[model samples]
Target: MKHAQTFEIFLIAPPGLEQSLWKEARAKGFPSARYTTGGVTLKGGWEDVWRANLVMRGATRVLVRIGEFRAFHLAQLDKRCRKFDWAKYLRPDVPVRVEAVTNKKSKIYHAGAAKERVERAIAETLSAEISDEAPVTVKLRIDDNLCVFSLDTSGEALHKRGHKAAVGKAPMRETLAALFLGACGYDGQEPVLDPMCGSGTFVLEAAEIAAGMTPGRARSFAFEQLATFDGDAYAMVRATLPAPQRTSLSFHGSDRNAGAIENATANAERAGLSDNCHFRHASISDLQRPEGDPGLVIINPPYGARIGNKKQLFALYATLGTVLSERFSGWRVGIVTTDGQLARSTKLSFLPESAPIDHGGLRVKLFQTDPLP
Candidate 1:
């Protein structure tokens, strides 16, 4: 098997949250990391790719640029792709899926045709079967007559951390939750409470971080099917992970729905974080600050656009603000909401707003407030 000493690695982030993800990548010691419009990029080896997939909390997917060439037409594209060393990068036994996109300036403008040509080249040169349902994917981009190929090393989206069997309506994705937690300055050392904790995403994520657990510990990746993958080396990478540290503080979550609390508790058990997290059935009006050093309180309340009526959500937000201000002073707060009016209804003195974040097709912003006086 052949491996490049260093190749381009792209980590996809949610729109408007690239800076947060970039900060995370840099803090993780990817010195070469820099943010693009939709993601961050770095130059790294296969091991770095493996590590990113296994450890990055904010990345939605990790892609590796394999190779590229300039070709104006289909025949040229086919000849060049065949000449490229497919066998060195792909395994003969693993089925592959190919996807392509082209710009207007490219002579090979048909995306379907381009994908078919590349698929045929791989099949002929490496004897790899092509399947639409294949776990491994080859992505192609033809812009200004230049062809670029990349591999989606992340099979399932990273947000599907392989533990939660139950999810609530408008459930926040784990990647998005991690980025929000980072934005709110939650470093896992302090206790966190989510008053509207629908499936306990915020609470569980905070617990995992506080416990020093890697988000990918429960999941697998697509790189395992590639020809260059070294199982033994990858096993060493996993083995070398520092043990998860014990946390002194417990995370708390509450929801009005008894079923949601039950689901959240079950999800915590499945993630092996029940000991560090506690879930209860309580509404926002009933919430009282847990006795501890003041920490962070974050919530993803019911958004008007996704679930409830806007008028109804306003009162809910206002009530939330009233409860937090009256009972949870000294705790910093972060709320994720789509409607600015709804966020304002909280009446909590918020700091400057965050960039609009894309969550489940709705634009949401994080509203933060300093420790209440």
Candidate 2:
């Protein structure tokens, strides 16, 4: 009897957030997990994969690397696919989708040809028909003359927890928001304030974590459709989830846009996290510190993509600097912006920081400030 094989967990983090993802993976009790530029690799079963998809905020998606082999040509790819133990993991009745990626040094550089070969191999090997529109997606990567096959345990990106009904104009993905929050060291034991909380994402993710909620409970994943899936095991693991802590974590968010406030409120409600999170209609000009243990303040203000101009937005940064400098002494701050000029106008020295995150093709930086002196 062959046992379930162990696979690597690929965590696609925002460009500058690798350390945060690695730190979170360790804190999740898989401390031995190794990390790389874009993600972390860990050992676990499907249950662990499911747990990672739900709880790992730092990861855009959690992928399970199932197969790795060298295939220099179409014949080699077909042979390798046929030799793979598809019967061990896939379900005959469940639909399957195969995706392929190619890079330099590969003769089979044409991705469409590779995808067709792999599909035919799977069909011929398993006597099953191929379907392009399956609910479950199997990912293939052929880079640097190496072919790696992985399963996207997360169906839609993990950010779409099936909750957020309303989104801001320059809305951030929930996964990216959580990862950014983690990068800023949001531990939930301390107050978290997002002055420019367009859709209340930073505050909401914080509230959920503070309340002891498992990010996966409120969502579903694609791995459940696999033939080898164990419902009993998953149910037991899920049953062990800690209850949402109802403490006053002081999760606060405000946006100048009235519509943004309303959207945040509705999003928080939909996430079942309204109790711990608060959204108000306010502006960066009106920010002040609240009395509590010193916590983190994160702002994803306008970066001139959808709102505000470079010159005009400097005023916004100046306002943010004034607000943080005056009221939130001793509170840590993180500001996301694309322009070094805009960051400089804040009048705060954010020395020794990494390059900006490349989100949507924009070079964005996470500027950190020293505690009030």
Candidate 3:
């Protein structure tokens, strides 16, 4: 019963990274894409939804606007929900979970009550069961007396990427890593090094991008469970993406902890990027530039507030700056830290700092420099 028509597709971006994601969407041929507070919006069909989930590297998740209606009260909400063509997008055999949010302006102030009304209506009218563990989900948002419905086409946050099972404390998410790399103007043609690469996130992501691999190729999506899903057609669409290309350059990572290096190596192997990414145990004092074309050295070094003492961190940052400046001429640098003073202690002439980004509750920013002269 699902009809083919354009609908608003929301691609969620991390806070303060909306402009980077918008550029990515536009470069990927979604020319009509526009930035929003926490994401980018564009008009596309279900196929576009699948593609967005599969190809977008900077997006945390993709939501498709399924339908909308105005309901002033819970009774009207239930009445309108029953009339909705649930069969068009949901299968009777598959379980679904419904979540709702309500604003004070709406007559239905209780989100739990609104969710219960819709759940009952779907169960009775469509004969579908509700389960907390269901892969498919329906989301409702009521604001200013208008109710909007959306489907979370991405079941799990896209940052999982189905490859990185190991992580250390205060690790960066893959989505954020990609956005940071893109912000640095990484085109995947040059080498990338992460001196503090935990779990090999930046190194592995760089390798995958360099090889033209789709971020979601190794994973499944919630769209596969929808009633209108066409596995064969979707497979063809995936096939049409640019094939992986051979790269002469290699990505690199290093850490002082042997366990961290092991985890990074294992993660890279699992992502089938071990050949392109290499990891070793080394301290900042022992660091040396790898032999390759002048490319990028991107790192999320430890900050004062979380991992180490503020007083001691200044020496560490100064040492990093001394090493990169002496050994890495012609290579660009991107350092992520929460404290501006800590970043300044490095003595690296970083360009104007990027907008403060929210990383797990703390405000962080990236400070970069042009190729060292």
Candidate 4:
């Protein structure tokens, strides 16, 4: 395994949050990080790939560009793939899956045929088994007659974080939650409060960040099955992470549903954040300021698109706005929703809306406000 060889690493960011993911990558020591259309790209070795999977909170998945070639057609692609150095990245014993996407500009416009060629090449040349259920996946993107091969180093989406067994009807993904927190200028020092917390994604993620906990600590990554993986070296990488920090600031979450409160509490316990995270069953009308300095008050309340009727939600939003404005003075606010009209109903002063983000097939934006006067 050539651990020292550098390659282009891509961190798939949530739609419209590429800049946030890029900032996080750079801050986490990937100085070469640059934002692209769908994700952030940087140059690093195998260990850096492992580290990105381990610590990056905003990335949905990490991919490594193993190699590339020019293929005018399926036959040419098959020939090049057979001759490529599969041994460098894949082991013969492990099953592999190949997926391909091609644009019309490419001569090899049939993605299915391209995928078959690559999978056959690996199975025949490297003597590896090909299975749809394989844990290791090779992603090939063909554009302008150039086929680029990338390995999905993170098998499961980074949002899974391997915790939180329970989820509500419309749960905010941890990746998006982390990015939203960043967009609100959260630095893990001040506390975070989610009035409409669902499964406690925002509160738990904030708690983990404040504690200096690695997001991937409890999860296994696809990179471990690659040929370049070295358990001892990876162990060293994990060992070098900053020791967990203890903070007095607490993360709080509340929900109108009792089951959501229970789920949030259990999730906090599973994430080892119970001590600093507090969850209770309370409606938006019942929300109160915690006994401490004002921090961030972020929530993903029910929008008409996913949960209930739009007309009825106005009163809910209005009541929420009234509660925050009347009680939680000096606290910043971030609201995630698909409807701008619903957001405006809050009657709170909001900054300009963020870029439209894709949430569960709906386009949503983050509405933010500076600390309340």
Candidate 5:
């Protein structure tokens, strides 16, 4: 049997993704959980941590919930902080950081004071101190009215795939890009195109998927820092990350901006996907299908706020719709945009097929049209 220890795990995501995660957790066989804005809480262990990191399409961060204690006053807070088993997971040599969030009704009005108590507690109990005034080891987060302590198990944001050293402006994050692709039912078997391929995120992600790649394989997770973490198990995990088979699929992307095309090409090469994905400079007014393979057309066009011009933004979206409706008649389409109204200007009739999604603070939405005409 697998060793299972109950931890109060918190799965952090964008604001609206909580419900989706809740549904995902149930479908994926996680136990019942409590949820709030930006996250969900449940019981899990290191294996659960690994599974969540590797498999969860929606989760941005998986926080291993250490402990949570409540106190209305400063003295009470300090006394309670010292009682945690910080020693179990922390070491004296490893440095740490402290954070705190206080509610309106509490006497602990000063977040600084709460952080001090936790820092003192860690030093006294674990014989280790927090100095991430340029932190080295532990990280902390305090939510509204509550301090739910966790060690940062994902170091850099999960989206920093270390692949896209060159990026397009207003770039969508890798993890978010992956989740949205999954939401669109991209199985890596069909040809994929990005008409507004800013930075080539969709094309690159599609190429990686087609090549049977795991998004987390190329990066180091913060969990590797845990005192109880096992390296041998992780190596085994990494070794199994690649799929057994690869396929021949065309991932195509186009942008009117010459600079963006160059950046996309460089990023694709950096991601080891240059051979699988094709990047070109073309306006949405002229995007066309490749010779073969019926597939999905995914786009992330510039909204008014992103590009700062409303008329041009609507025109771009409108052109994107025109190309989709006329040229790519048999292809499926998925358009990601923050502006529902701007997307409305696309006038694709398939506009009703949209699904709302969230990315960090942004309320993102996907308008999907299909090949089933």
Candidate 6:
């Protein structure tokens, strides 16, 4: 994989949110981005890969396709892997892990055997150490006898973002929160609120987006350890990012748990979003409309699948609905939950439910309502 050559870059999306991730990629200036079953793909060089890791909020991780070949058998795969140019992307000094996945349609059905062959090739040919705990990873997918090799450029998942040190039970991931915010028509110009703000994921994400803060600004990437990495060039890329802007609008989050509020406030302070993110301890019944132009009110309440009882949650959902309906006029509502009955308990007129999304282990849907009348 030459540094100058453009190749396929894949952005892994959270199972059912591929289109949403693609939309974000396109809006971020990857005009030719296309959504596939599990991710979004585009053509880019190494710098584009770095940029994607640095700025893309909705991508779980970035993978860069280095090369591919067709191999019908293990011997053929071994021969091809040994002959392939491994030194172009991987460093001799850095350790790497090879992970392979093969499907029934492929003759190379044994993924473990394939992985061993590739590992041997890289170790012997490029002199790169192979370790199971390596920070850098080489991913291989063999389907229909074609082997595609990709590098996981983002070391930790992008959701880590290197800022939040605390999280609540059933917390929303930052990547999913960004996509859900986009689904609610949040363009970083309006206010956002989360009633059950666990560790303040939604509020902090909203404030960071509004301030134009790069998601990966505070983190390091796996690509930095690869052979193609250029420290001075990457520094220049980071330097060119637009300066964080100041915003007057405040993003609010409230929860009944005082500990949760403390965690949220600490998270905001760590992310440098304390200026625009306000967290308080309050229950659903005490939730009040913020004094501002009505923007968006999004919440990810307990689904009863992981916490609390389903029968008792009906009353909680009803109370949330009653509070929002009576107090939050002109504010759009986005509720994430696994049960249709719980969403309906709100009694707020919602637009059709979104396609089911995979969050944690549950299939959750975003139920949105137009601004409350």
Per-residue C-alpha lDDT of model 2 across residues 1-373, encoded as one tens digit per residue: 1246567778777777777788888887675578888778888777677678766766788888887899888888888888998877777777788899898778779898899988887777766657876867778899876889888888778878788889978887777777777777677778889999988888888887777777766778887876667888777767766677787777889998999999999999898877778888888887767767878888888877657666678888888888888888788888877877787787876756756676767778888876655
Model 4: residues >4 Å from true position, as ranges? 1-3
Compute each candidate's TM-score over C-alphas: 0.97, 0.93, 0.97, 0.99, 0.87, 0.98
Candidate 1, superposed: residue stretches over 4 Å from native: 1-4
Q: Which digits, one per residue and each the tens of the lDDT, describe model 5 over residues 1-373?
A: 1334677777876665576666656655577666677777778777778766765555777777677766767787788888877766665666677766665666677878888888888888877757764232343444444556777677667677767888767888776776667767787789899877888888888887778666666677766666667777766766665463556777898998999999999998887787778988988777877878679888877776666786778787777777677777678877777887887787775546444666545667887776825
C-alpha lDDT score of every prediction, in listed order? 0.91, 0.79, 0.91, 0.93, 0.72, 0.93
lDDT score, residue 87, model 3? 95
Q: Please, what are the lDDT tens digits per residue for candidate 1 over residues 61-172? A: 9999999999998999999999998877789999999999998998889999999999999999999999999999999999999999999999999999989888887899
Model 6 lowest lDDT segment of ten: 1-10
List per-candidate RMSD values in Å: 1.3, 2.1, 1.4, 0.9, 3.1, 1.1
Better of 2 and 6 by TM-score: 6
lDDT of 6: 0.93
Residue 58 in model 1: shift from native, Å?
A: 0.4
Ranking by TM-score: 4, 6, 1, 3, 2, 5
Better of 1 and 2 by lDDT: 1
Off by over 4 Å in 6: none
Query: What does the lDDT read for residue 160 in candidate 1?
Result: 90
Off by over 4 Å in 3: none
